[model samples]
Target: MPGYGAPQNNGYGNYGNTGQGNGYGASQPYGYPSPAQPAITVGDGLSWAWSRITDNPVVLLVGFGLWTVLTGIGVEASYTVNGVEHSYGLGIPGGNIISLAAILIGPIALAHVGILTSSGRKASFRDVFTFPNFLQAFLAILLSRLAILIGTIFLIIPGIILGYLFSFVAYAAVERNLGVTAAMRYSMRLLSDNVGLLLPFALIGFLLYVAGAITVIGWIITGPLVALMTTYAYVRVQGRDVARYPSQG
Candidate 1:
């Protein structure tokens, strides 16, 4: 079990301590290119993601299961009426709220699981409830979504650009403990520097998302795969090293 930038064993048995100090910080001043960062390929990202999944199947599956249930309950179906598109949640009246919450909480929980398992600690499904920088992450994600939506209203291209630019905002907030503006800035720098390498990976992730949508069970695999892949890309793009599994050896 190899953790990212954090120590392998930090002595905290429970999920109380949020994993931090991964070379991502406000002090570093983002939005600049790192000249020495190596190029990462789409194959490398997918391979790393698959390796992590195989190595930590139980934790990943458990987390993904929780995410799926919450996400499904809060799932929204959209339809067009008189050239206007509208959506509603499938669950109860406030199901949309639950769905929005799921989007924010699910991935961070999975990242916590990643931190635990990678640090050689056994992770519990309850780790999904542990959120670090909750307010910051929530605001960053909300604002980014709103901005992307506004861009989309103007034209689809700006939305896609904004999507790519702020793709790693959640990871930045969760892993780096960045504030709302800092997280967006960090993500923008990462994307701007690695667009050549990251574009293909994003395209593949989109395909996986579509594939996952076709079947309920498909999400069990693709959901975590995409999450892990994005996490891997985040680390690599930042010029940090990822732990290679035994099979990758």
Candidate 2:
């Protein structure tokens, strides 16, 4: 929290009063001041994410469970398609597509759960499918990934840089209901001003994910925790009081 700029009144006031009463209460307007805390370091981000996960095990776990089921189905479909392609010596399209769709959509749902949980609301598994701007969220995520993939093709560093720069696209799309292009632009703008703090946060998150992948079950915790952490960063960057939530302790 050290490097976050002075906490601006992003109109959300405290974390607890996210304007959930009105549909627009959950997020602040985009033009508010940047976060009051310093840019978040890796340790801070991890700690904050872990705390949220621990504090709201039921919410994160239920969300993760639903996500796991969908992912498992996608993996099964991919495997089945690969088998058919191998047997017939014919190309089968959309095998990887299934997996890609799962990857893109799963986070949007989980991020929604994280947003609700972090705001001190009780979230159910059904909340996973409740994104109001589904079309925009899907398109925004797809475009962001496409951009990153294109960047990686030319140079590894630019791709990695773009990945971090646009990391918040999904959050903005879901929470703020921004259009696909606007979400990407908003994420880039926020990161451009705070990459120094957020880059390490992203790196640490990557390391945690890798460690979790070593034991697939570990992701049940790490995955949602990382999502929650990212949500926390988004809130902080938007100048909300992340520490106001009991989970932040």
lDDT of each: 0.68, 0.67
Flag clash pairs in model 1. none
- Point to the candidate with the largest TM-score: 1
RMSD to the hidden true structure, all candidates: 8.3, 7.6
lDDT of 2 by residue, 1-249 (tens): 233223233233343334333222343333354245555555666677777667767767777766765555434313346456422212335545666777788767776676666565556657777665789889998888898999999998899989998888887776766778888888898888987767766887798789777887887877777777787777766665444245331
Model 2 lDDT, full chain set: 0.67
Which candidate ranks first by lDDT, i.e. highest?
A: 1
> TM-scores of all models?
0.75, 0.73
lDDT of 1 by residue, 1-249 (tens): 022234222233423222334522211112333244335877877877787778767767667777877867867689999999998666577777777788766666666555444333445656657766778878888899899999999998999999889888877777766778987887888899878888887899999989988986888889888877787777666655455533111
